[model samples]
Target chain A: MKHTHAEENYLKAIYMLSEKQESLVSTTAMADFLHTSAASITDMIQKLHNKGLVIYRKYQGVTLTDRGKESAIKILRKYLLWEVFLVDKLKFGWSEIHEIAEQLEHIDCDTLIDRLDHFLGNPYCSPHGIVIPNADGKIIDKPRWLLTDLSEGASGIVSAIKDDSVAFLQYLGKRNIYLGAKITVIEKIQFDGSTDITIDNQYKINISRKITDNILITL
Target chain B: MKHTHAEENYLKAIYMLSEKQESLVSTTAMADFLHTSAASITDMIQKLHNKGLVIYRKYQGVTLTDRGKESAIKILRKYLLWEVFLVDKLKFGWSEIHEIAEQLEHIDCDTLIDRLDHFLGNPYCSPHGIVIPNADGKIIDKPRWLLTDLSEGASGIVSAIKDDSVAFLQYLGKRNIYLGAKITVIEKIQFDGSTDITIDNQYKINISRKITDNILITL
Candidate 1:
């Protein structure tokens, strides 16, 4: 079905929220993410439900239907692929790709995406470490471990990051810790939820628990 | 001033046509490029002129104003940048990115392009070998020579291609001649308007004069 950019956005937001929380997404959350009012979210949610792109129960929240999930995944694939293009091809900062990807995700052309996939050499993941689903919505599974989940003395290469914010990515840039960086967990602070890590034998740096959780490692 | 995607498309078509031939863009030509009717082109030209984005003189034809030039360049920048992103980052086939870039150029965000510029490492040209203008519409100058103009036995690296059509790009792909291929001109036959060329010391090939004109080279 032909959907407007706004409608597609709502479905994508619901899909992402549901993925993160593993539950129905609240109207307030949708409203916040979309930067629209709760009333607007309600209206759009109802519209989406009617279109069979979402399953919504009043006041209980919303989730995407199978069709909706497919659509959302398609949009996400475009988004992440464009992000990879921006970062890998255009040399855009990792932090800056999200907003551009948001705009690109609405481009409705299957052939374009497939060709883009070929142009980018069929990347398995985006710059931010998110998997880009193939044309059939299949994602390549990679071995990953969260930084916070690693024990003291554990070591691995920095494979990807969960958070894609420009600020966080820029911080990683400043620290010289990026994708493919070899890292060792030097110490774990139980009290403050922080960790000391060494990168490439250069420096030992302290990172907050929040930052640690955002980093992904591959053994 | 904000312009709709449809409006931008119209202006871009006019701009490209005017650049190629005369300053006066015909409604029929506009319609042909935009896949619309002459009547629709006339309607859009009137609107664009009314908004001071174009200069229209009835049947005499239409031209873009300084403002229209700025707007067109902006769209061009977005389009080319996205093309670079698609081919360079996402691994999309060059033929595939044009249609998608056509849609993405309308996304209204200045920072997105700038950030994309940084992410793509400030590419001076797109995958199709089109020069990418800077934010202020200043084009980056590169030393380039057309394959048709090169003397027989002249050797240079393929820098860009003049043609962007899917069929043409795919043909180049089939011949293993693309942007950045090291090519040496072997023989130029003036009568048949064809050339014999050697690529990377591997194979000597005969190329039609028409194809030769489309290939751009750099020393």
Candidate 2:
């Protein structure tokens, strides 16, 4: 029932990739995502297949079996819960908690996780606005769109983010952009696709299309 | 420098053994303490010696170098701090925190550990009454004696314990024996070494010499 740290990481990778791709995840894609070699990905995929965690095809790719999906969700649940704890309780910057949560997620103690959930008052989402899956792997996810997708004059609250990289998170932190912050698009530059937006109607600034694309919003 | 989990475990084993023996730790003793083979202990000792973490001499056993001792104390600090957090914040029983702390100690982030120390209000000791080393590996250890050494009519407060095994802890828990509890020895049996004692002037119980020897008390 327990997986190695490497195995858990692979499962999480496949799960994330599957969420976006909606198909079997290629070994090449897995290699790129994990920054590993294709040969190593193939080798690990075969190992996971043998463990009944994944279904691997020679040319097509690999997909998580039911068991593997459960494992991945458990890891994610721990990860997001720890992220909430780090930011909400420990006062760690939101940008600083990802790596720590990455290490904490692999700790295999259901009771500790449950106790932490209670200790944190059972937060519904992480600081990044990502919904935290429950112990039963049930998640309450809502539809959200990238900030760049909104038209001029459109206003909405920040919901989630597509990128969780430190650089991106730190950039948002410096700009006072955070989950649940309200923003209204003032104008869109035709040439660069950048948008001028007012954050809580306090100040206006132009952010690149790339940054806008990563910021999810709920109108 | 970062050490692998296995290397850290070896360092901790050597440090603990050195504390008790006040000399080099034999490969046989290390093997027994780690529940591993002597061959493996020798192999790891040789590896640690190469890494300047330990000094290994043939037949005389192994001892931690200054670098190795620092690593061991760091792990101990994390372990004890987490035990305090689990008991004080998360409401875990004293007996249940040891195994969880054992796993948490290997988390290798200095910032996280320091923040945790601050969050716990810089506690000086763990729930088991063991002095927790600071970030600089400095510890404030008070002198204490095993309960079995006390004579009849002797009175003291429980300060620490020599054994942290779950069984021993659970036994103490069931008998209402805890750190800071006052005890007065009523009778000492000469034949078996078992003694009768009152806990906090609440109840009297007869405990075996093995239990008495493990419980450290401060007069």
Best of the candidates, TM-score: 1
RMSD versus native structure for model 2: 9.8
Clashing pairs in 2: none
* Candidate 1 docking band: acceptable
Cα lDDT tens digits, model 1, A99-163, are: 87898889898777887787777766777777789999877787788999999999987767787
State the lDDT at B53 in candidate 2. Answer: 95
Determine which window of 10 residues in candidate 1 chain B has minimal summed lDDT.
B87-96
lDDT values, one for every candidate: 0.84, 0.87
The lDDT of model 1 is 0.84
Chain B TM-score by candidate, in order shown: 0.71, 0.67
Q: How well is each residue in B1-219 modelled by candidate 2, as lDDT tens digits?
A: 899989988998888889897777999999999999999999999999999999999999998888989999999888888987887678677667777887888888889999999987776677777788988899877677789989899988786777867677678878999766789999999999899999999899999999998888876
Please, what are the lDDT tens digits per residue for candidate 1 over residues B25-116? 88888888988889998998899999999999999899999999889988989899888777655656766678878988898877778877
Interface RMSD of each: 3.3, 0.8
Q: What are the chain A TM-scores for all the models, listed individually?
A: 0.70, 0.68
